[model samples]
Target: MRLFSLTILLAAVTALAGCNFKSVPEPQVSARDAEWLAQVPKAEEDIRYARYLMDDETGETPGTIVVDTKQRFLYYVLPDRKMIRYGVTVGDEAYGWTGTSRVARKAEWPNWNPPAEMKARWPHVHPMQGGPANPLGARALYLYEGNKDTLYRIHGTNEPEKIGLAVSSGCIRMRNIDVIDLYNRVDLNAKVIVR
Candidate 1:
């Protein structure tokens, strides 16, 4: 009876392991975006992050944006049980947050109006014009819970070297080029889960 039960368990495990999942390709970069992307300095190999199409394990529906703070990874769930995983920088323990929200707004090369909390922490920070020098980098996705702004963002960072680290104040940070790709892929009003 023990051997029979073991065989059944093994069969079940093998069957689940054999389940097929298709690859979802990353979105293409436009000519204009590519021009700027080329100008950005490449991250050192040690700090560089790789984007990949992976098997969906988050169990969320397609088009959901999931941020795993502990792993410092972000996943854009795709149809057919696939996801696009990108390395990211998350908030440190002092400011880490976990919640669900919807992307209420988006901007390209967005101007930086340092939040009051940030301003209090760094008094020298001032509103800056949008450009390559902007800390917000190439794109910004504002997360909100219904009509209330959560004051948290999933945005591009000029500091690409910080990818895969927990160093942000309370925002999710991605590489400039990667964020542009994500900006194009994500739809406004899409659900975002940060855990």
Candidate 2:
């Protein structure tokens, strides 16, 4: 009887091992978006997406966006203490601003309007229409404090190579594909915490 039971258990384990489970498919990138992505350099392996386990240390409630500027990571808190983390580029020290805010509004392929200060610094500054080639690569989540626009953004970037650096003026920059993924997962008015 013991030998018969052992044989059945082994068969079950072997069958389970042979079973193939499919994973979720990646989001489809449009032809225009694909062409644009082909132009930008690939991000380093360290900056790639990963699942992180969250604990009480992550004070914010679920669905909050926590931007770790020092670590160059953005965490979108999910249910059951799991988070989807993406590598990001934060603003350089001179242009960096840290505070709590909310996603006031969102836009797809948002236009690039150089602020007056940026234009003053570089007279060549000009607004660029929204498209694959635009600086705001594929999406923009406008951050706001109360009803006022903070003029800072968490948006996709044309430069994928900048994903793990501090180079933006003040906006949090994400890779086009990563930003699009985040754009889909987060809701308008979601809490954003920068640290």
Candidate 3:
């Protein structure tokens, strides 16, 4: 009986000691990130309109293209004229879009290259890998129409404060949390109408 009790205790301790690993998310955010995260609002049912209002998504109006200046929101208009509308921050009146296109591809944590047009405009954006600091934050939706690349994209931005401002170099930028939410709802080859 004495030996059995000792053996049970040893087994119990061994079992508890071996299960010490903590769960970690893939692309873990660090301490600094935690601080930054404190500022961005996670989507809530009350503030649901604060980010997006997803309806049954269809192929007709394939995806989302937010303008940060004019405060306009465009949902792909399906064969039925049903489109989801959400509030947005159009690129500042000085730097908003005046063209159109479709979503050709989608990328998570995409690289950024300041277009030649942008290079002359900002002169600070060099082609670079996407990261926490890169203008493109967690994802990117590349836009195209037919065989023509519209040179536009809806992407995540590190500047959470700019979600409602027209401060980007050119592309449509969303909050990291908001963009991730949007990414899950879109697919490749979706039409994106940016006015």
Candidate 4:
């Protein structure tokens, strides 16, 4: 019986791997909104130190995060309480959510371990463990409540076209390049509000 159960489990796991279909986001040309990716000129930095010029001064905004789902925007509240909004991709309408929390941790080239619940839902879905192909992309901001990890992340994504799309299972994703830009601006204790 034990042998039979073990075989069944392994077979189930193998059968459910690689079931998701995802693609990279593309650059859409707009006369008013220049392609952000193209506008950015290559520069030298540790990646840890990549710099960005805010389209507007954030010197007076408060240090808060406001995510508007309908607009697919994320704003980093500046010192005086104003915000700098950025385009983003969020979880699918059926699978997404809204709430408030704090960014407790951040990671570069983050590792991905599908939660057991996720594994159970789609038995044949397996993404790369941790690499360029991983959905987490180049960086991740771990969300938390007090001492508990909510298992949600404000992370980077390869799918830029997906920005303004509701298709993630439950994560807040930004293009890898954009997340890298935001990651640099956010501090450890910043609050995040998604609506």
lDDT score, residue 162, model 4? 70
lDDT of each: 0.84, 0.80, 0.58, 0.67
lDDT comparison, 2 vs 3, better candidate: 2
True-structure RMSD, every candidate:
8.2, 9.8, 15.5, 17.9
| Tens-place lDDT digits, model 1, residues 1-195 | 999999988987676457543333555766755676666666763322557676898999999999999988899999998888888999999999999999999998889999999999999999998777778888899999998999899998877888888999989999886788789999999999999
Q: What lDDT does candidate 4 reach at residue 18? A: 46
Tens digits of per-residue lDDT for model 3 on 1-195?
Answer: 999999988987686457442221223455655555554444432222244334434344434443324654434332343444443445666666666566778887778877888889867769978667667777788878787877777876665554455665557776665566566667677656665
Ordering by lDDT? 1, 2, 4, 3
Please write out the lDDT profile of model 4 over residues 6-48, one tens digit for every residue.
9988886565444221222333333422333343333332211
RMSD of 3: 15.5
Highest lDDT scorer: 1
lDDT at 48, model 2:
32
**Over the full model, what C-alpha lDDT does candidate 4 score relative to the true structure?**
0.67
Report the Cα lDDT for residue 138, model 3: 74
lDDT of 2 at 33: 68
Residue 101 alpha-carbon offset, candidate 4, angstroms: 0.7
On TM-score, the candidate that comes out on top is: 1
